[model samples]
Target: MWRRRAAVGVPLQEGKRVLSLLDDDGRGSHLFLLNVAQAGEAGLVGTVLAVEAAAHGHGDAPRFECKVSFDRRGTGWRQSSTFGVRSTNLSGGLPADGFAFVAPNPPPAAASVTITLFDISSGEPGSALRPVLPRSRRSRTRLSATTTAAAAVLLR
Candidate 1:
């Protein structure tokens, strides 16, 4: 039994959220995946964590919903995801690999994806990724995810 919860178009303030997803036995064996498609000055710091649970074999639990409530502040909550994780579909556990949508990259194993969303507000699409580039390279107009995606980076 695979489990995934998707809360689409949800707004999130500038801060952190710790979601405790565990089975009835209080065990966890899931991975975290994030995607951002927002405008303006926005950034996210997400940490996928796992603590010692009572057991580690409940990886195939049924659909479970994690409900959390918090008081909204003034503003700055951007439209975010109803994050979905493939607990049942992926069999053993999450894969430690990147997504390949087309030819440059192969098709995705699962229907999950991670993208580096940079603010193209600066006009140059890659401007957000390389905020501190030298004056000698400001005339170039290219859009490679702007580098530092490091090994996970795909230059499409």
Candidate 2:
């Protein structure tokens, strides 16, 4: 099963927030408002959000989420996913053929999501997954941080 957490009504005021995943056994994923909608339960398209291994889990398990948006009239299908993979795996575990939902257009409004991996084994998030719930909300944006970078990062 997949573990998901979300952040809505994000202030698109030009900044960043850090989404930390403290585990690998699970992952955090999101769908753009538009992408979540359906035009008859067919998903309207046959595309999947491409989640790079780098966007899956950190360390050996890589934990991350995919973001997408849907639109009324069913004209949009945008897709975007984020996660991290084990630093040792140059291939990122997931094959290059992997795919996910893509948002065709920018969100009509301000919204963001963050999924956290919980240790089903411990009935809570694992050691790698920390800062559970009420995800961090910052006013600054920064580039993706590699394993070498600090655990904290800014999101936009």
Candidate 3:
């Protein structure tokens, strides 16, 4: 069975946010979002609004694609980023479980974001995989601390 966790609505600065997708056996991949601030003082910064995964194709050769939507913070702009794992290579074979997160050519500004995990093989929306909020104050604190540390590192 495959299992995954997501951390959504994370607040980040003008840097990168790294998200890890973990399975039941503690195996998974990482997705990253790079945030870029506006130039000078006139343009609006770019921000990520949500991330979702869905199955592409409908037959035996279906593949997985991760979609990320951007929020220009009210700048009347719409941008999307996609990541995918091809089901077949030149050798006409399926590769092992693999994933990647490619940053947009021009990074967007920092903003709140949501991350999701889905299984492309199942061909069903994995709503059950949505992350549940930490129930305890300690858990929230720990998550915050970790996120802060990660942000610091990425901003450097």
What 10-residue stretch in candidate 1 is worst by lDDT?
A: 98-107
User: Which regions in candidate 1 have their CA more than 4 angstroms from the true location?
Assistant: 1-21, 24-41, 45-72, 76-80, 88-156
Model 1 lDDT per residue over 1-156, tens place: 112221222223233222222231223322223322223332222322222222233352322211122212344322222221222232345334322121112212222223222222234322122122245744552334324221111211
lDDT of 2 by residue, 1-156 (tens): 222232333322222233344343336432211112232433222122223334433323433223233333344433344432212222444333333332322334443322322233333433233332343544333324333221221121
User: Residue 14 of model 3: what lDDT?
Assistant: 50
What lDDT, from 0 to 1, does candidate 3 have? 0.36
Query: Model 3: how far is 62 from its true place, Å?
Result: 5.4
* TM-scores, each model vs. reference: 0.20, 0.27, 0.35
lDDT of 3 at 115: 32
lDDT of 1 at 43: 29
Ranking by TM-score: 3, 2, 1
Top model by lDDT, which number? 3
Candidate 3 residue lDDT tens string, 13-93: 355453444332345443323344444443324332112243232223433344444445556655555554343322422
Q: Which scores higher on TM-score, 2 or 3?
A: 3
Worst 10 residues of 3 by lDDT: 147-156
Off by over 4 Å in 3: 1-19, 22-63, 81-83, 86-115, 127-138, 141-156
